[model samples]
Target: MVSVALPQIGTRLSASPTGLQWVVDAYVLVYAALLVPGGTLGDRLGRKRTYLAGVLIFGAGALTCALASNLPVLLAGRALQGVGPALLVPGSLTIVRSLFHDERRRAHAIGLWSTASGLAMAVGPALGGVIVAQWGWRTVFWINVPLAAVLATTAWYAVPDVPGTGRQSGERDGDARRTGLLADLDIPGAVLITAGLAASTYATVVGQSAGWGSAVFFVSTSITVLAVGLFVRRERRHREPLVDLNLFLRRDFLAANLAGLAVFFAFVGAIVYFSIYFQHVRHQGPIAAGLSVAAIGAAFAVAAPISGRLTHRFGPLPPLTGGLLLAAAAFLSLTPIGAHSGMVLIIARFVALGAGVGLALTPMTQIAVQAVPDGRAGMASAVHNALRQQGQVFGVAVLGAIVYAHQDYLTGFRIALLTSGLVLLAAAITTLLLPTRRPRPASGRSRHQ
Candidate 1:
């Protein structure tokens, strides 16, 4: 939705290419930064409470965006919007984890969740386009307000409250108070990671526009290294680290996260560039561009549920590897597209891209969650989502730089697609080579073991 509205935003707000990138990155950066904290909070507080609060915050952010008169205000609103998702995404997944105990049932439930997400992704662009065409880009933001309200109301009535860590049956509130919520949370670690990610993304996005030799890039690069270095050290030492460094020791967890990063990097970069190409290069209106991008979402919605079933019948390895390979092939196919390319070829590539993502996303998420103990489901979900969000940030920052640096949009587009294809290909190979672990039945054994 935001992708299709970007051109209109640029024109209306008098924004530069770099500013446009910030419009997207601002939301993703804040969302990625707070995900771990949000998940931890959900674990310590209540998942239901956190989820509802997030919805309210998200609605407020949407309202703010709809009313924004300047780029700064819009960016701020986008950042606020990020805050809401940070809390809600992990909370929702944790709820699902709690509800479904059986492995197959859980996988199928996750598939349904993914399907809902895919449908949203599918509808957002086309709907945003129609809204933007009819009422302007600002109207696109306005729609979220009503939807958020409905979701909050429905969830309050329908969703059950899941106890936070240490708050299970027969446990008293005193147990949770032993360490205190703030004491249990790694605030310093969160701050360090957030700062590191922001600095790194800033450097990446600004480097091409400001020149690599510029003081802004150099300083940001230094900060990035220093902050990330400090964050790693802090997480290693902290008792209740925002992210458990040990989770990476599990081969399945590591592979799933890496694959997640690669998949999102390619998917998000492609979406942004494709939207731009349809509108700016192909001279399509917002409605047409939205409809064009809808092919990806439509195919995704169709494939995600089926992938869940496949993952249940076979191991995650088959679908995960195949999906990545398919996405890579789609990226490679898209490399030759130009302003004059036929609609059939473009739509076909988009559909393939969508299907690959749908197939892989569910199993990837399942693998990550299953790798950890039930106690850490929220944390695991947060870690996976956080990495995915980081992938989005890097995708936009790096790929957008490539596109803008080249005078020819087509050349830049081709190069970006080729780079994405290679990245996916490498991820696919890595996933294939990693040890395969079938999801176990609901026996009392640890899946990680």
Candidate 2:
């Protein structure tokens, strides 16, 4: 929605390129930063309760954006919106994990979740464009109002409260209960990670305008380093870390997370620029431009379920590697596109891109969940989502820089496309290196032995 509305928002708000970038980055940065804490909160509180709260917060944020009168207000609203998804995304996944105890059944459920997500990805652009075209950019935010309301209502009525780490029947621990919610939040780690990522992203986004050698850049980079360093150290020493550093020791887990991050980094970078190419270079209307990219969403909706089923039967490697390679080819195919390129070629490439995303998302999500303890499902989901959001943040910022650097839009577009293809290729190679077999679950015998 934001993508198609970027041009209009810039025009209406009298925004420069940097301002437009903030419009996107502000939401993503905050979302990525808070995700871990959000998941942990769910693990302590009930997943359903937190999910509903998130829905309300998200709706309020959307309403704020819809009513915003200036750039500052809009950015604030976007930031607020970010907070909602940080809570909701992981909570939803946690609920799914609780509901589906059987591993195979859980994979299918995850596939359905992926399918819904892909459909949203497919539908959002076109829907956003139409809303923007008909009523203005404000209306796009308005659309989320009713949708959020309905979702909250449905979740409240239809969803059951899932037991958390120590909250199961006859299993409640008095020590954990006595500690209270504040102790479980890991405040220091949360603050450090958020501040570090925000500073780092601020430096990256402003580097083009402020010059990399500028004092502002130096100050920001220095803060980023100090904060992130402290964060890693704090998490390592904390009794209950925001992100368990030990998760990375598992080869398959690391690979899946890296693969997910790379895919989003490349795909988001390309898609953001795709909107720019259509409107600025090709002179297409917002609706037309959005409809052009709808192929990706449609393909994703179709392929995600099938991929999930395949992954359930055979493990993640084949689909993960093949899907990434396929997407890379799709990115490579875009190198030939220009202002005068036919719509058929553009649509075909987008469809292929969508297929790749659908195939990878489900398996990647399952891999992340499998790598963690059953008790930490919320945390696992948060890690998966947080990394992807971070990738999206960097992707948009970096690619936006690349696009603006060149004198001609076409040259910049080509470079961006080629870069995306190469990144996906690298992701494919990384996926290939993952262990072929699933790790055996730790057994009681291991403790005795």
| TM-scores of all predicted structures | 0.91, 0.92
**What are the per-residue Cα lDDT tens digits for candidate 2 across 1-449?**
88678889999999888788788878877888788778877777768877988999999999999999999999999999989999999999888888876556677788888898778877888899888878899898888889899999999889987756646456432114555645566888888987887787777667757877899989988999999999999999999888888999888888889988898889876787887788889998877877777788789888888887678667788778888988999999899788899988788889999999889888888888778876787888888887887787678777777777899889988888888899989998988667786533434553343
- In Å, residue 288's CA in model 2 sits off its true spot by 0.6
- 1-449, model 1: which lDDT tens digit per residue? 78768879999999998788788878876788788778878877777888888899999999999999999999999999989999999989988988887677778888888887778778888888887778888987898999899989998889887767756466542136555645667778878877887787678667857877899999999999999899888888887777788989988888899999998898887787888898899998777877888889888888888888788778799889998999999999989888799999888988898999899999999888877776678889988998887787778767877888799999998999999999999889878645766655545542432
The 10-residue segment with the lowest total lDDT in model 1: 440-449
Off by over 4 Å in 2: 10-17, 166-176, 438-449
lDDT score of residue 192 within candidate 1: 87
| Candidate 2 accuracy as lDDT | 0.82
Prediction-by-prediction clash tally:
0, 0
Every candidate's lDDT? 0.84, 0.82
Task: Please give the lDDT score at residue 184 for candidate 1.
Answer: 64
